[model samples]
Target: MTATPGTLVLAGTPIGDLADAPPRLATELASADVVAAEDTRRLHRLTQALGVRPAGRVVSYFEGNETARTPELVEALAGGARVLLVTDAGMPSVSDPGYRLVAAAVERDIKVTAVPGPSAVLTALALSGLPVDRFCFEGFPPRKAGERLSRLKEVAGERRTLVYFEAPHRLDDTLAAMAEVFGPDRRAAVCRELTKTYEEIKRGPLGDLAVWAADGVRGEITVVVEGAPDPTPGDLDAGELVRRVRVREEAGERRKEAIAAVAAQAGLPKREVFDAVVAAKNAAHGAPSEGKGLT
Candidate 1:
């Protein structure tokens, strides 16, 4: 006879204030048969703060060993061990290290559940004063400058609000890149040390925020950027379209990407924008127009 598959519990830890830890988190931490933590030291501090001692074995399950340890944890689940996974703060898988274990557990038909607690994503979004009805959590931008700019460009025309997790040190460069790609006038919010004693939410245009972060920011950071604004009908003229494309190109975007981004912002077809750009170029170079003009 096969043994009953055990459950995998993903518990959310407090982002800052220990008081934010949910009661269910402590109970699960105390009762789980096996506890996996991103940082064993932090986990010890957490348990101590909550006055809960694990009745089961505790182990480290961080980025370095996540791959190797996943199978071992999965095997334990198959053998009916209750495994609880927790990160240093917030949910395990959101820019953290629980995705592999969760995916592995799901593959083995193991029961998986979550103890929802404080979330930096939602907290920052709520405090951002930006549209929260529709949004996407982009996690973290690429660390390298070129990759980071490329990533920002991909979302240059996203209609829904965007949320991202970034390290304190890179906040300035990231915000500057955002300003360049999303436009300096785009509204955004930077949430720092969320739920902590020094919690701060800086709200302003991307250009201003970029300047503000130049002096450096400290603590956990969550950035909320307003979505691309819908262009008015009057704003879709041929000259305007061409100018928008040029702006992107000037900011290091490829001509193709610039055209696509302009098209997305105008809610027009790419072909239409391409034709407008072609017509503008033809007119400038004293050549005959090869395509239809902007309507």
Candidate 2:
């Protein structure tokens, strides 16, 4: 009889509280034939805390070694070994490892599944008090200010609530940059040490949060920012549209691109914005304002 192929199980570990580790997680940890973890040391601690002895051959599987280890893990799976993949916290392949291995397993026709558990992204979003009905998880901003700002600029106009993971040390600067790009008045929440004893959620305008974080915070941090507000018809006036276009231009957007962005934000056509600019220029130059023009 042909033996059934093995399965790849991506289990979610507790983000903080040990009790959050589901019974299925424990069972999977104890029964899998091969267990791969981001940090074997952390895995050992988790197993000890849960009083579970993994009956599998434990191996290290993290970002640095994932590429090299994936093929090996896939081979084990092909040999009918049930492979359990876990990260230090939360679900794997989410800003973590296990994605490459899972992709490899799928290519070989091996079954792949996940054990749902606590997610910091969802946790922060829920507590953020922002609109969670529609949201996007942007895991970790770039460490460098320039790259980070460039990244932020790309999402400045996103209407869906935005979520991001940030290092405590960089929290202040990141918030400040966010305030600069997304606007100081933009509402946001900074959730730190989530699900832990000292868990704290700071909610306020980005500018205020930047000032507060200047003192420094500690622990796993997740930030959720409210989406840009919908533009009302009154906001599309020529002068308002011009100001919006200027804001984009100041952010390094090309004139044409800025006009398009302004038009989208104001719910106006690009031609309308172009005409507004031309008319404003003509009025300033004491030229005809309403005749057939460039736009």
Candidate 3:
């Protein structure tokens, strides 16, 4: 007879305050047969803080060795080992490690569960004062300036509130890029060191935030920016509509979907945006006007 596969627990660690740790986290940690941690040293601190010693072996499972370590963890889980996975902060696999291990365990028919706990994303969003009804969590912007700007441009017309994580060193540059791409007057909030002693939430326009960050900021940062304003049909000219469609296409979006998205943003019918794109294509080819059906 085959042994039952052990469970895989994805535990959420506090972003800053140790008190934010969930009650179940300690129980799971103490009972787990194997504990995979992003940083072993941090794990030691956390276990000490909770005053609960892990009953099983602890191993490092971070980005550096996530790929190599995933198979090993899965094998242990297959052998009926209750494995607990934890990151330094927040939940694992949200711009962190543990995705590989979770996926592998699931593929092997192992039970995978999560311990609901603190999240910097939700915490920052709630404190942002921006629209929490609709939002998107954009993990982190690219490191390179050109790539970062390109990434920002792709979502320049996003209607949902945007959230992003940024390193302290790059916060200024990132905000500057956002000011340029999303416009200087766009309202935004910068959450620093959430739930920690030095926690700060700066709310202002993108331009102001950029200027403030120029002087320097510290701690883990989460930025929340207001969504793009919905423009009326008359607000966007045919050339601008075509340009928006082209931008989306360049960003790997299907032309049809791109046209529909631009139409929604401009609050116009999809047919209108499709016509504009068709007209622009014909004009670029120097072709005479011929009524073309929307594809």
**In model 2, how large is the Cα lDDT of residue 190?**
98
lDDT over C-alpha atoms for residue 45 of model 1: 93
Model 2, 104-160: lDDT tens digits are 998999999989998999999999999999999889999999999988877776789
Which residue pairs in candidate 1 collide?
Answer: none
What are the C-alpha RMSDs, in order, of all predicted structures? 5.5, 5.8, 2.0
Measured against the true structure, the TM-scores of the candidates, in listed sequence, are 0.83, 0.82, 0.93
Model 3 lDDT per residue over 1-295, tens place: 8888999999999999999999999999999999999999999999999999999999999898999989898989998999999999999999999888878887888999999889999999999999999999999999999999988987887889999999999999999999999999999999999999999999999999999999999899999999999886788799878888998898799988998888989999998888888888889899865646656
Residue pairs clashing in model 2 are: none
- Model 1 lDDT tens row, 37-152: 99999999999999999999999999999999999999999999999999999999998999999899988889999999999999999999999999999999999999999788
Which of the two candidates, 1 or 2, achieves a greater TM-score against the reference?
1
User: Residue 82 of candidate 3: its Cα lDDT?
Assistant: 94
Those runs of model 1 whose alpha carbons end farther than 4 Å from true positions after fitting are 232-265, 269-295
Go through the candidates in order and give each one's C-alpha lDDT.
0.92, 0.90, 0.93
Superpose all Cα atoms of candidate 1 onto the true structure and report the RMSD in Å to 1 decimal: 5.5
- Displacement of residue 61 (Cα, Å) in model 3 is 0.6
lDDT value for candidate 3?
0.93
